[model samples]
Every structure is written in structure tokens, then in C-alpha cells.
Target: MFSFCWPALLFLPLAAFPQNAAPDAAGGHSFSNPATAICAAWAGPATDGEKMRRFLEALTLDAYVSARHGGTGFNWRDITSLLARVERICTAEPARSLAEVWQERKTAWHRGSWKANTVRCREILAAGDCNEDAFFFGIWLYAYDQAKDGRSEATLQTLPQGGGAMVWEECERTPDARLLDVLRRMQGK
Candidate 1:
């Protein structure tokens, strides 16, 4: 009996560990960089939808701050490129490179196609159909939650218009707390 149980006991601790636990992929959305860290401070515990919004928001805020300092504006092309980098870091897909996904997302954005935008994002999360992957699922949840809250429009508008960079020149800036509050409520905290 001890011999039979030994195998089970040996594997019990391993079972408690996450099977997919791997180090975060290098590049894109790492917590190492100062800018990413500032953005992540608000994003760490956020839901999937919140993560996506925050990711998009970071770009907008960066542009806003840059422009406020009298710098040139950021273009959609450049912003999309940055997002592509983020996509690469967030997932482990070989096909459909983040750059490609970024372009697809841009196309949907220009068409004013929310469904397409959502579908694209969902694809990014799953990297394919019917995926149950944790990271993808998490980000998808963020998008879904953001949509349900009716805050996407406000966020979209807050971004610079005409593809130019936007800067918030104000010395003091705060993230939209309502969004964060909703996230906390969703998290049951």
C-alpha cells in the first residue's frame, strides 16, 4: 500500500503548481521598463478588458504627455506598431504575428466596426478558435467587461483625434477611477 501511494504523494505537490507556468516572454509588455511599470501599476490587478483598455490607454496617455511637452504627435501607424509589440509579448502564437494582428485591428478600427474589433482581439487572445488558454481568456474578459460598462466610447474619444499624438499637459493626471472601481467590484474585493 505504501509503495502504491508513494507515486501519488510524489506527484501531489506538482499538481498544485500551474502546468502552464513559464517565465513571461521577453519584450513588449514586461514590467521591467519604467513606462511600462507606471502603466502596469494601474493595470496589474485589472481584469482582461481593463488590461486591453489600459494597454490602449497607455499609448494614448504617452502621446498626450509627449504632445503636451511640444513634441510631435504619434500616428496610428506608430501606435499600432507599439501594440504589435505588446501582442507578441502577451501570447505564444507562431502564426499570425503581432504585427499582422495589429494591422487587422487597425482595419477594424477604421471601419468603425466594433464587432470586428472585438473579434480581432478575441483572436489575439486565443490565437485560434475555441481556445481555453488562460492569458487569452483573461484579456478577452477585459474586453468584454469594458464593452459592457459603456466606457469604450469615452476612451476612444479621449485618444487623440486625426491620428496625431495627444498630450496631457497638466501636471497632475489621474487614471479614470470609475473604470478601476468597476474592476475592483468585478474582482470581488
Candidate 2:
């Protein structure tokens, strides 16, 4: 006769599961939204030009997804325009750093309560205004949501892009004041 340990069997499922499943390494759980994750990384202190480019690529995909989903209250055209402005900033003279831009924006957001930030994001989303400030704030809100959901670093390296050269070309053609300000700050001007 064989004896089975019932108590040990109860612990089997727990042992099989990851104790702290890392979102970024989830093999099969495709991120529901990658733009937010990329944006979180972009806002962090470690970002560089290459990281900015990657974040832009992920944002483009998110814009497409917003267009396809149709009920998320997202205006895809506005999102595209917003991304273009960000790209322009990245390609500017001296190249604005996303980390710096995020710090500035985060500081501004923190001047008010979280409720105020939420209200501002809602207003921007509802107004459908595509100005640089509004667009940046809106995307920042998305990134904030992703961070809150513990998906900040989940899809940084997995998002797809058509190519980097074309993005750079378009970025060279666009211009933004906020980005210019960052460049100025970096130059001590």
C-alpha cells in the first residue's frame, strides 16, 4: 500500500506558481497596453535617446490599438499628433531628454492634488485638444495608470516598430516649445 501526503498536495499549486511574478518577463501574458509601460520607462531617470525612440514606437502601436478598440474614448488621430510632437522634441537640437521632460511635468502635476491631476487628464481627453501640453499631459496620465497597475517595465523591449530612420526623419520635421525649453535648460541657456 502507498500512502499520500494530502497536506503536501495542498502546497503543490502554490509552489508551482511564481511568488513574485515579474510583469516584464511574463512569457505569454501579452501586455494589455504597452504605451503606458514604455512611457513609465521613458519618464524614469535611466532613459536615453534610444529609449525615447523605443517609447515613441510603442506609443504609435497604442494609438493604433485605440483606433481599433473604438470604445476607450481615445481619439487616435489626436494621439498620433501628440506622438509626432514628442518625436520632434526628441530630434531637436541637443535632443530633449524624456527624463527631464517627465521631471518637469511631474513637478507641475504634483503642485496640485491627485484629484486635480485626474480632472485635468479627463478634461484634456474630453476636449480632444491636440496641443503639445494637453497631449503630453494625457500621455503622462496613461503612463501613470500603467505604473499604478504594476506594468511599468513590462513591454519595453517587446514592442514593434517599422523602423527607426523614418521616425527620425519625421522628428526632424516637427518642433515643440517644451522640448526646446528642455534643450535650453540642458545647455544652461
Off by over 4 Å in 2: 1-109, 112-117, 120-122, 125-127, 154-189
TM-score per candidate, chains pooled: 0.22, 0.26
Worst 10 residues of 2 by lDDT: 1-10
lDDT (Cα, tens digit) per residue for candidate 2, span 1-189: 112221222222322221222245633112233333223322222244344344333343443333223213333334344444444444452233333433322212222222212243233333333343334333333433344334444322321232122222232344332322222233244
**Superposed Cα RMSD, model 2:** 21.4
The alpha-carbon lDDT assigned to residue 10 of candidate 2 equals 26
Model 1 worst lDDT window (10 residues): 163-172
Tell me the lDDT of candidate 2: 0.32
Q: How many residue-pair clashes does candidate 2 contain?
A: 0
